[model samples]
Target chain A: MKLTDTFKTAIIGLKTNKTRSALTMLGIVIGIAAVITMNSIGAGAQNLILSRVASMGSNNIFIEPGPWSKRMEKGSMMQSMVEEANITSLKREDAIAIANHPLIEMAAPFTMGVGRIVYLDVDKKSSYSGITPDGQKINENNVILGRDINEDEVKSMAKVVVLGFTLKEDLFGEEDPIGKIIRIQKTNFRVIGVMEEQGVQMFQNMDTYAFIPITTTQKLLLGTDHVKWIIAKAWDEDRIDEIVSDLRLLLRERHSIYNPSGDLAKDDFKIMTQKETADILTSVTGVLTMFLSSVAGIALVVGGIGIMNIMLVSVNERTREIGLRKAVGARKKDILNQFLMEAVTLTFLGGVIGILLGLTFSYLGGVILGNMLDLKWSAPLSLDSILLSAGVAIVIGLVFGIYPARKAAELSPIEALRYE
Target chain B: MAKTTEVIEVRDVRKEYRNGAIKTDVLQGISLKVFEGDFLAIMGPSGSGKSTLMHIMGFLDRPTSGSCNFRGKHIDSLSDDELARIRNKKMGFVFQMFNLLARTSVLDNVRLPLFYSGLKGKEELELAKRAIELVGLTDRSHHLPNQLSGGEKQRVAIARAIVNNPEVIFADEPTGNLDSKSGQQIMDVLQKLNNQGHTIVLVTHEKYTAEMAKKMILIKDGKIVYNQKVDHRRFAKDGFEK
Candidate 1:
């Protein structure tokens, strides 16, 4: 028979049993929808995390004390906490020396202290950061209310603090936070400004913190010049590695340490560049997303099996029709094409419906995150995700539908004609 | 007969089936010839191989040990595709059950044969309409097969069979599934087409229906027993029972 005639027969057959065909298509539709939705959600999360990391200043480098510092020969527990007392490596003077390097644009020394912040009647546990005037530039924090601490204020030991957006909301509510007094660790400090709303950064809420001048924090609270870690930015985006290496060498030389190699087993301090941190986060998120989609793939397998089951039933029901067609001069190839086309058409329709539903769900996901967490959720619809889902659906349909279509096409006309 | 006028020739066709290990011979050394413009009926009891012979003649089944030649061409040696082409273009088939596409309208059912005939353009529609009109189903053209009565469905099947203007029309028990009135109406339609010089071959068990043919051949045990030509004018001059 003519190819057109065969296709016409298939279309008429499908039209005659619309409900059965639709139900068969439903299995593929749900499978495609699940695959597409999972991919989109996974893609959205990765993008959100990447951008948040980028906003924290892509070129910024982080240097924190590694656990190996406690294992040094002369290290007591307290001396290990203070890298300078270990006398084997890194000191606060090393951070200043690195900042003085030609490739380094700015450097900030940080010492974390736990304190309850009190404003009016409410008191909440918060971390206090002691930063140089340049720390604001290094961390990409720009004050939205008043102003960042000036160099003069840091040098003169002013007791002024800049509160993060969330800290301000808890301390002052709708009241103006600028020029307000917030007591930290039994010491009253005047609020100079409120940082803009920064969402989660590296798993820590950025909002529930306050920044104070490093000299003032050291003199008034800790009574020591020791700092927990140092953060620095390169003069240009490309020189960060060079700056980190120079800082490590300078600290090793000044502390009279023989070995300069940074073996975690022997090193007295740890210095992590921004590249390393971002790489860790990216790999973490990448593996996480892949794992999630793989879990969702089980649903797709079940759906593909559903399609195969229904198509087998269709072949059984249409045995007589197949026999009549063959007797009327339809070639076996023509019969095969007709059934294969029906299978593909079912999957293509399902893919379209799934894409629409997935996007709608992704949009709703973003809205819910934005309202509940006060975090701007940016889950964009990715085309690669949609195309990948469609390709998978087509493969599943063709692979699963082949057996049944072949069964229908290979039916002997005489035998099928005799089938009641 | 003229040398170039032979419409079909079956030369010692043999058919056999192996049921498990035992071979059953269905058609044993059968030979026949049908000329153009002849109306022949094959009469036989069940298992007499009339249906098997009809399948071979219609190119739907292959003979085991002989040749089926149509219009001087060896159809038995043709490929499946070639056989299908010949069946689509040169042969028409009317099955006992009416075999109309159940959900299709009478017009589309008539158009079914034309789809396989490799015919297109406005001429295809015109020819289909003319065939439907010949079957006296022009007014019911848009009605589906299920909507039509038994006789009307049989007429639609006939129109579909003849729509391509085939060289020979094969009806295997064409009225076997119909009522007496519908059966007579169908036989009358076949007789009118035969009068128009179209060749027809039918298989039937009913003697009354077999008498409508100008020539009747009876088969028993895979062999022709009685072959005779009846003058229908003799019946028309008297009554059908005479």
Candidate 2:
């Protein structure tokens, strides 16, 4: 029979029993929609993480103290002496040493502490970061008003601070706060700079911080000389790996640790590049996407089974019609083609509906998630996902449509015609 | 005297159907010949194996140990697809229940056989229209089977059967489900087709319906008991009630 005629016949059969066909297609619709939604959400999350990581500056590297077990293993008296000799740990001297490397562009040693700030009638708790003047350069902290902390200020341990945009807005409102004095834990400090509005990065509001000179924070505010972390920028992106190895070796030598290849957990420090962080995020998101898609794939399989079950029922119900068609001149292949075509058409229609619904739901879901988490939500409907869904729908139809079509085709004309 | 050309020939056909370990012999070595342009009826009581013999002769069932030929070609050994092709091109069938497809227009029902015949486009439609006209159902071409009367449904079935212009038409209990008036009308239509030189084979237990045929055969059990040319005087009045 002509393929067009077979398709027309199949369409007519489905049209005649609209409710049954729709019910059969429901499984497929939900299955495809779930697959699309899961994929879209997974891609959106990965993209959000990627953009956040990118905002951190690819050439930047961070160095921090290692696990506390390594530090506590020393005797209590020795630990106290080690703490007092902050230059022996991650300190300003190490930052100066790293900054001297030809491949290193700049390095800033920083320490963080929580402090209550009072400006006239307003008082609020905020994170106070102490950084050198080069911290602004390495961390890409752009100043929109006044000036940044300078070397002379750091050397004198001057009580001066830079307010983040949100901090300035909260304490001084619309008034210029660059020359104003704010009390940090009851210590008065002159505001040297107000940072530009940078918004959120890595899930933290960068606008809510107050920055001071590292020496001032370490010696006066924090009452310690040890720095918490060090930020460094690379002169060339390609030399980052070499610079990291060199820095690691230099730190190991400076700390008098032999066998640098030994267990890294025993090391007193940790160094990380932006690429490593990005790779970890990618793998994490990849696994999440796989896990979610598999869960949705189960729905597709159930839907396929539904199609098969309904098709078998249809074959049984139309036994007499099969007999009549055979009697009129329908070959076994004709019967098979008709039933198979009906299944494919049913699933194809369901797939189209599923794609549209999936896109809508994914967009809605993205909006909700974006609002809750305060991140940009772009609809992640990739062409590969759309095509893969369509392919899966067709395959499910063919695989599930086979058994019933075969049964219908293999029926004997005499027996089928005799069936009540 | 000129000899008639044989359209279907059945020789020593035996059919046995097995249910588990039990076997029932439906047709025991029955032999028959159907000629072109002849209206022949095979009459028997229920379970006499007349329907089995008719099924074998119509190529719907295969004989266990005998050979059947159609138009001088041995068809018992033909593949299912080959047999289907011959059925599509050379045979027509009308059933007791007037098995028209439900929810389908009468015209599409008639055009179904031609779908596999490879007839293209307008030509297939014209042939279907001619067949519908032959069955006198042209006005109800677009109506579904449920909208038609019993006689009209049978006529539509007949139209479907002849839409491919087959060489022979098989009617199995054609009026078994119809009233006397409708049955008479069905018999009249069969008779008129026969008069127009179409070969027809009918299977029924009604003596009045068999009386309208040019030749008749009576079967008892699995074997034929009487085979004779009908006497025209018995059905000359054209109505069974008279």
Candidate 3:
């Protein structure tokens, strides 16, 4: 039999019962749609996070004062992630050394503490970070009023502060408050600048902060010689790994750690470049996408079973028709091909509809999610996903359609004709 | 005298059905020859195996023992697919229930056999039209089966049967579901086709219907009680009354 003829016959059979055919296709439609939606949303989320990370200047690296435990070398990969050392060994000298490197643009040693600041009668509690003018520049914190603290202030251990926009609003309120005296931790300090309006960056709320010189913060507020963390900006994008290795060697030599081998666990500090952070975030979202996609794959399997169930019912219902066809000289393969083609056509059509629906839904979903999360969503639907879904739909049809088609083909004409 | 060609021949064919070891012999040691251009009817009461015998002869069922041959080929020796090919090219069937596909137009229903005959669309359409014209359903060729009358539906079945221009036609209780007027019209159509030189094996319970055929057999309890030529045949005359 010609494939076209068999296809026509299959179409006729399906058209005879349109409601059932559509209902049977719904399962496949939903399955493919779910898979595509999951993939699209995953891509959109990855884009949002990666874009956010890139906005923080790709050359920046964050250094935290935490040494890995000696057990890291013998432990699993995940176990080596534990790196909260109790000893505060990171000093301001380490930041200065790192800042002097040829590849380093600037290294800002920063320490933070929460203190009550009394300006006139307003006694407000706020978090303050002690960093230099270089730290303010690298973080994109532009001083809109007055002047930023210079390197001379750090050498003189000057007790001066810069107020963030929201903090200035809370403390001074519509008044030009630069050069005004504020009490922090029972010590008097003059506000040198008011920074421009800055919101959250890298999960840190930047608007409600007050800044002081790192030496003044270490000597007066908490009375410690150690700095908490340092932010390092590279001179250029290339050879970041070399700079990181050099920083590790320099720190190891200064701190007198005797290990010659470069083990990250033995280092006194943990450094993560913005790219590494973005990569980790991407891998995490990738796992989530894969997990959700597997769930959608289950839906496809269930849809295949739905096709099988409906095909079996159709075979039972059309016993007499099958007998009549056989009597009229339909070979077993002809009958099988007819029924199988019916199923494949159904799923393939459903796959097309599903791809369109999935794309539309994902586009809408990206917009909705972007509005809710306050981030720009740029998830582009990929051709690989479309082709993958189309192929899956056809395969499900063949896998599920085979049994029922075989049953119809193997029917004895006499028995089928006589079937009531 | 010219010798007749045996289109189908059976030698002591037995068809038994086993229901959990309880055997029922539907056709018991039956032997027969169907000649080309022959209109033969096997008439019997219900459960007398007339339909089973016709089915065996028509290659619809296999015998439990003995041999049945069609066109010098043993029925048991041919594969099901090979038999299906033969049936498609050389055989046609008309059932009493008028098994036309529901929701399909008369033309497509008639064209079904040709669909499997591997004919091109144009040829299939032309042959189906000719078959429908022969069955006198040309006017109703585009009508769905549900829209057709009982008599018209039977005519559509006849059209489907002869669409492939088979060498032989099998009619099992062709008029059993129709009124007497429609039955007379159907018998007339069959007789006209027989006259035009199509070998026919018909199954019927009605004695009057059997008499219209050139040869008749009476099957009683899985065995042929008697076989003879019809002496008086009734034709579907104008305003014919039974």
Candidate 4:
């Protein structure tokens, strides 16, 4: 039979029973939709996380003390200094040493203190970060409206503060706050600059916090010589690990601590590399997306089964038709192609509709999740998701469609016509 | 008899049916020959195996024993593909119920055989259209089978049967489902085709219908009781008197 005529007949047969055709296609539609939606949402979450991490800095390594290293070093159930040695040993001197290392470009000592800001008629609780001028470069903090504090400000112990972008909007409204005075606890400091908006990073919003010189903050606001933590940057991408190791040795010597030096097996402070963090993020996101897409793939399998089942039923219902076609000289291949084309058409239509629906769902879902997470919602749909889902649907159709088509084609014309 | 005019030949054709473990014989060593341009009819009571015999003759069923040849080719030994090719290109069929694909247009019903004949191009479509027009259904070509009258549906079936210009056309009780007027019209078309040198084999229980053919074969209990040529004047006057 002519291919066009065969297609026409198949189409007419499907269209004759519109509801049955739609019900048959429903499984495929749901499967494609679920697959595409899961993949898109997973990709969106991954993109969001990577941007959050990138905003922090690719060269920056976070040194968080780990429990395993502390336990290995102390070998005790309860020890006070062991835990403190593990965490608090990451101090301002280590930051300066890392900064001065041959492989290091820049680093900053920073301490964070929390206090209520009171001005005229407004009072709000906010984080106050004490940082050197170099911290600005490491954190990518840009002054949107006012100047940032200079190195001279830190050296002279200037009693000046820089407001984060959001904090300025909250405390000063439209008014210029660069020269205004804001009270931190009992000490009032002059605002030197309003830092640019840095959205939100990890758990802190740089836009909401105010920056002051580390020395002045240590003496006046925090009331101790100790700095909260140190943030460091690498001069070159290749020398990050070498600089970190050298900085650790220098800090150990300067502190007169007798902890093993190259003993990550019994380390005092933990150092996590940038590549490690990136790998962890990629692996976690990959695993999450795979898991979600597998569930969607299951739906596609069930949909394929649905199509197979419906086609089998159609073969039964159209037994007489099959017989008639065979009698009129339809070859087995022609019969097979007719039914296979029907199956593919059903799935292809379903896939088209599902992609559109999935894109819509992803957009809405991203907005809802973003609002709940308090982050910017930008879940752009991936074209790969649409194409992949379509490809999957077609494959599913072909795989599940073959058996029933073969059954129909293998029927004997006389027996089929004679079927009661 | 012309040596080159034989259209169908059967020799020692035997058929059997199985109902679970028990077997029953349907056709017992039957043999027949049909010449081109002849109108032959097989008539029998129910359970005489006339339908089975017709099926074997029409190539719809293979005989259990012996061979049937179409245009001197041993059809009994041919593969299903080869058999289908033979059926598509060499033979046409008409059923008692008209067997037009319901909900399909008259033109499409007529064009079905040509579609299977592997004949492409506008020429094939025009041929199909001409066949429908020959059946006086040019105006009703677009109407579906259900929308056609009994006589019109029969005409459409005739058109379909002749569209491929096959060597033989098989009609099983062509008039069995139609009223007398429509049945006569159908028989007239079949007779006209026979006169135009197209061989036709019709199966029927009605003597009046069988009388329309040039030769009549009667079967009883899966056996041919009588096979004879009828005089045209006598057949026109009163058909078989039983």
**Best candidate per lDDT, number?**
3
The candidates' interface RMSDs, in order, read: 2.3, 0.8, 0.7, 1.3
Decreasing TM-score order of the candidates: 2, 4, 1, 3
All models, DockQ values? 0.41, 0.78, 0.81, 0.59
The Cα error of candidate 2 at residue A46, in Å, is 1.2
lDDT of 2 by residue, B1-242 (tens): 15989999999988899999999988888888999898889999989888888877778878898889999878656988888888899999999988888899999999999988889979999999999999789999999999999989998999998888788999999989988788888888888788787899999998878888889999888888999888862342367562
**Selected candidate, larger DockQ, 1 vs 3:** 3
What TM-score would candidate 2 get against the native? 0.91
lDDT of 2: 0.86
lDDT of model 1, residue B141: 90
Fnat (0 to 1) per candidate: 0.29, 0.73, 0.87, 0.47
Identify the CAPRI category of the predicted complex in candidate 3. Answer: high
Looking at model 3, residue A347 earns an lDDT score of 94
Q: Flag regions of model 2 displaced more than 4 Å.
A: A67-89, A112-128, A156-158, A170-175, A181-190, A215-228, A260-263, B233-237
* Whole-model lDDT per candidate: 0.77, 0.86, 0.87, 0.79
Ranking by DockQ: 3, 2, 4, 1
RMSD of each: 4.9, 4.8, 4.1, 4.4
Tens-place lDDT per residue, model 4, A5-75, is 77788787778678988998888888888888888888888888777777767678665443234442332
TM-score: which is higher, 3 or 4?
Answer: 4
Candidate 1 — which residues are off by over 4 angstroms? A1-8, A67-92, A111-115, A151-158, A200-205, A215-229, A251-265, A370-373, B1-4, B231-242
Structural similarity to truth (TM-score) of each candidate: 0.88, 0.91, 0.86, 0.89
Q: Which ten residues in a row have the lowest lDDT in candidate 3 chain B?
A: B233-242
Q: Estimate, for each residue in A1-420, the C-alpha lDDT of model 3 and write its tens digit.
A: 898888888898899899999999999999999999999999888887787788778898777776655443232224443344234778899888999999999999888889999999999999999888788888888889998889999888899998988999999999999889999988999999988886666645677889899899989997889887788899986878888878888888988887687777777777778887777778777888999999988998898899999999999999999999998899899999999999999899889998898999899999998787655689988999999999999998899999999999999888889888
Quote the lDDT for A116 in model 3: 97
Superior by DockQ: candidate 3 or candidate 4: 3
Worst 10 residues of 1 chain B by lDDT: B233-242
